[model samples]
Target chain A: MATVRAALVQEASAQFTSRQPLVLVVDDDPDVRASLQDMFESVSLETAVFESTAEMLQHGIPDRPCCLVLDLRLPGTGGLEFQAQLREMNQFVPIVFITGHADVATSVRAMKAGAIDFLPKPFRQQELLDVVSHALRTEGEKHRDGGERNTVRRLGESLTPRETDVLRGVARGLLNKQIAYELGITEITVKMHRSSAGRKLKSISVADMLRKIDLLGI
Target chain B: MATVRAALVQEASAQFTSRQPLVLVVDDDPDVRASLQDMFESVSLETAVFESTAEMLQHGIPDRPCCLVLDLRLPGTGGLEFQAQLREMNQFVPIVFITGHADVATSVRAMKAGAIDFLPKPFRQQELLDVVSHALRTEGEKHRDGGERNTVRRLGESLTPRETDVLRGVARGLLNKQIAYELGITEITVKMHRSSAGRKLKSISVADMLRKIDLLGI
Candidate 1:
């Protein structure tokens, strides 16, 4: 557990330099940590090996594609408990668990809790890497570049409530005439608001406005 | 294989009746197919097992979240060959392989080719299920309701190229003046185009147009 903390810093530093899927290994065994690190690194994947969940928490979750490789048993908060805590905190990183002893109960509980994969000690290197690869690829689809979403959110915020209503209707493929009729407003009013919204959003044409809005998911 | 194919048809019918993730198992063994189908169905996942990739192809790819469980050695096209063929045909599905006797070379090759998990026969049911769970969860993110994307595409096709350029600039957060200058057009012309495009798209306001476009991903 102690040696895991020491290696944690090195893993964090290496992770910042590359845009690869991250594997966060939390194990008490220094040898297991080292072996997992080497295996992941061999395939050009980055890893952050921690001895304890607390130590891993100090650095916070890395803001990139990553998966957790947890040992079933730990010093303070065991793998299962930490997993539950993460869920409570609304953190959704995929987790793969490893343990020396195997039990049907532990495996079933882990899977029910959404653990990605569980392996007994002395697991095959290729087998573990393959599971990690799948985890990362799956998580990749969800790591939607947080910064971009924020900017889009801010842009949408500039719209008036009435404008937003029209926007939603239009985005959902409703005709302006239909939107106005449904909202008990004149089509002319809808056109005027649409024009104003484009001006505020800095769009130059209808296509441009729609394209921008679609991308922003406004 | 014959029994597997029979079960596959049943699985396909069940999958069509619901939105569960499809686990396509390509194995030559009947016992393997029946066991895998029961395993997946128990957890509410749909299984489409085939004795060979060719037989699997006959069913075509199901239109839903899916992962492939491949047995490395098979008649006609082997697991690896079918994997490559799928790639050539532009199909990308998460794959898990099962083999009676495993070796380092084959495991490495399979993982490198993007197989999700590799298991030796007599694998724990939990292990296979966990891997399948990970693959399915990951694929879920990439599945964005195909029908919606199609509708969006059709709406986008209605826009003119010039309108699309304007929309792209707007989506990128550019100002009308900036877009006009970038496109060598006057700001007034940009406004007129935007307004007309809005009318053509049936969006009453600029915000409406932008919203519609965003949904269409133009």
Candidate 2:
């Protein structure tokens, strides 16, 4: 009985941990939000909808691969203002804007602010679907790339400060002599740090070591 | 009949003129090019292979969605220089680099120069295929976007010089009075220019006109 219960718990936990990719729809109109939700659902995509920025903010961001479908003319904190807020918080989630009243100036600001795409309302359903998919894929890449950098950073934590300096030099395409001179260390010492860093990071070649260090922001 | 003969000629011309999407593989290694060609063929994508940049250059760019799969360590010109050459010629084709010897410095330079993904040799076949598809999609978007910008530019040419100045001011989110003051013109003149610009572009709303002007580089 205990074993069966544990198996059931494990299955439930697995389902809970593995999230479905999502699209967050933020629009003031009920019809717009509902239509968007249904459209995403037709493609087997999950979505959460909000009528205002305040409500959307309360929901927080999900960890799964997701993109925002923001209506430009939202109540209170307009789409551009909310986008600025997201940027100030250093969140780089992909966003697609939908507006009934499309302006060149506002759209340019939205694009400059890093929006994925802008859809003028009465837009074809297929166009929105295409942009949604593109935004999700772009967000997925950012997440994966971020995770990769984190792994590289973890590996970097094992390096000594001297080893870190040596790794940076190599990553910059500097020779051991240049690194040694820059650090006021002997060439032999620089070599030792490079080797030590390599071994600690399990890197097999200068190229591989440099790749990791660069990813780690060395 | 004349119609039947015309139809036959039209079909033949269509077959010759309608080109398929292509991946251009440029590498010094004959084997690398061959393998890449086979991989693309497996996915029903077309490929053209070359042993050097000089040979690749001779063919010129195709008027279709395409990307270059370049080897970083070519015998002459090398990948980076060749990328520079393409840029100098006002070509912005997407490039994906593959190298057996990927060092941090060269890979970084390759990325900074806008090479897509840098795959080390011994990468999975699926990885290459995925990246190739991504590069093709990216190139496809660039072409589409360029066409969109061109259309916007053509629309912009309809505006009179004063209208163009007023469009710029409004695109900057400046009020009519502010634009008038800045341009040393009366508020009424600024309004007149804005209205004339709107009428010429057939823009129905402020947002719509602003979007076009922004794309037109106002």
Candidate 3:
């Protein structure tokens, strides 16, 4: 468990210092891509520019917290359609849509589909940068949550069956005698199993054990 | 606890039957207000029309799950400004913005402020209805979640001090002997308090008690 936790901590620090947060741009126009690339680069943010969804998908997103700056109208598949496809694939990269021509219906559709922000043509540079910052922060939170859940699950997998039963009874507010009666074991045995389980999980208190159990859905 | 739960259930049913879902409309033009009222009423929805934010505030929203259909431009306060005020007042009624001239910046701002949808003028009737339905459903979920949190708090308040101590220890996976040592009570006394707390909270298992304790943030 310590090793796993250490690895996660190291990975997080490595990401912060060694790897830069990325901004993906998918626009058919070369000028727009170049200008956007410059804009993101000016702020010390790494960016990857592509001409279309096909080109972006071919390269795939790197293993880092990232967001997409996509044009609404592309060469073949529209931005909305690409968003739907990503949802189907369970790729929840936050998206900010840029459009040359904006209508209410399309904007509503894009927003409803979970686009981070919709910007019509000639949008302010600062506005796009602010939205991208928000998107990256959101991605960071999501990654941390996922990592914590995985850690909890791994810790849960370390307990013995009897230890699990004893801890489960404790989490539910049951007395040792009551747990023993239910499991047809001695109250002393129940206590032993619970303490052993607590040490294994490194739970300092009943509340911590309860939380980990809840996180593990046990 | 039972009485509180029952009252909440009764209140929910009362809201569903006696009180129909409401759609509040705020528009400067009387014609727009009248047309929106007519549209909502056609679907058996009750509506209150107002010429401005002041008029709506004066009337006050009824105690029910509801949404707002707001015009972007109003006489006194703009739609965006009114939305901000509602947020500050902790009034989170879902909003659907309607505008004659749609701009990306304004639409983005509205959506960021938690507006349900933004529709430009000459929007399809069905589109407006669909958005209203979604907004009402969102409001219903928020109300139910609030009710549940309150119920959990009320249940937490019912525990005696000793009972709460024993339960908190149990929720953290503490053995009866350990909890008794900490509280300077006999193990038998700890067991008695555990059962008593479980009975009061109607907790069938340790997992259930753990969840209730977590919800109470103990």
Instruction: Name the top DockQ candidate.
Output: 3
Off by over 4 Å in 3: A1-19, A153-218, B1-19, B157-200
Q: Write the per-residue lDDT of candidate 1 for residues B45-101, one digit (tens) a residue.
A: 878889999999999987678899999899899998999999888889988888886
Winning model by TM-score: 3
The residue-by-residue lDDT of candidate 3 on B1-218, one tens digit each, is 99879778866754453245789999999998898899989988888999999999998867677999999998899999999999998898899999998877788779878888899888898999998988787777777776666666666777898888887788667899999999999999999999888887777876677777777887
Give the C-alpha lDDT of model 1.
0.78
Candidate 1 vs candidate 3: the lDDT winner is: 3
True contacts kept of 3: 0.64
lDDT for each of the candidates?
Answer: 0.78, 0.79, 0.85
In the order shown, the candidates' DockQ scores are: 0.07, 0.01, 0.41
Which candidate model has the greater DockQ, 2 or 3?
3
Interface RMSD values for all candidates: 7.8, 28.9, 3.8
- For candidate 3, the per-residue lDDT at A177 reads 97
Distance (Å) between predicted and true CA of B174, model 2? 59
Error of 1 at B87 (Å): 5.4
Sorted into a CAPRI-style docking class, model 2 comes out as: incorrect
Q: Please provide, for model 3 over A1-218, each residue's C-alpha lDDT reduced to its tens digit, 9 standing for 90 to 100.
A: 99889878866755453245799999999999999999999998889999999989899767577999999999898899999999998898999999989876788788878888899988899999999988888787777776666667767777999988887788677889999999999999998999888887777866677777777887
The candidate that achieves the highest lDDT relative to the unseen native structure:
3
What are the TM values for chain B, all candidates? Answer: 0.74, 0.73, 0.76
